[model samples]
Target: MARLVRAALRSNEYGFALETPRAIVVDEGYERYGVTAEIASVIADGAFYYLDAPVKRMGAMNVPVPFSPPLEDMTVPTATSVVEVAKALCGRL
Candidate 1:
């Protein structure tokens, strides 16, 4: 994932991928804790046309992380989530 981000930042013709386990709500926390939106903005402003596909972001559910183990597990992004998002980005979904 780090490799993908680094490549995206350096190349205008690559797609960006983000996978996180925290809820990225629409608030100050989004910017303070997550770089998904900021990365998108940079891509849009600097390399919109260079993109071959849309940005792919897979994050936790839009809620606070639960204290319980089971609930916490349900809140975060899973392997399936990553696979699905990747497929969608590749136009296979």
Candidate 2:
């Protein structure tokens, strides 16, 4: 992992961006917004040629997660979902 990051750092012509390939980004916020969105945008603009498929992000739903367990379960990404997404990305599912 460190090696990959180091190589990414070196290949980053933009100075701050870390280019990666077939990256799976997961967060606690909206998948299409915030930090995930920023990374996705950067990859799309810079390292897209390295990707075999479009980037996929897993995160909480559009609605705010509540304190209630039931509501949070519906809003947040589950471990199963993450695994499924990863499998789908790798063409395993």
TM-scores for every candidate against the unseen true structure: 0.58, 0.69
Candidate 2 per-residue lDDT, tens place, 1-93, comes to 434544563476534323434667688888765667666666666666667778777778887668899888788788888898888887897
What clash count goes with each model? 0, 0
Best by lDDT: 2
Model 1 C-alpha lDDT per residue in residues 1-93, reported as the tens digit of each score: 445654666774433322221221122222333656655555555555655665444455668767899987776667776667666666698
- Cα RMSD of all models vs. native, in order, equals 8.0, 6.3
lDDT of 2: 0.69
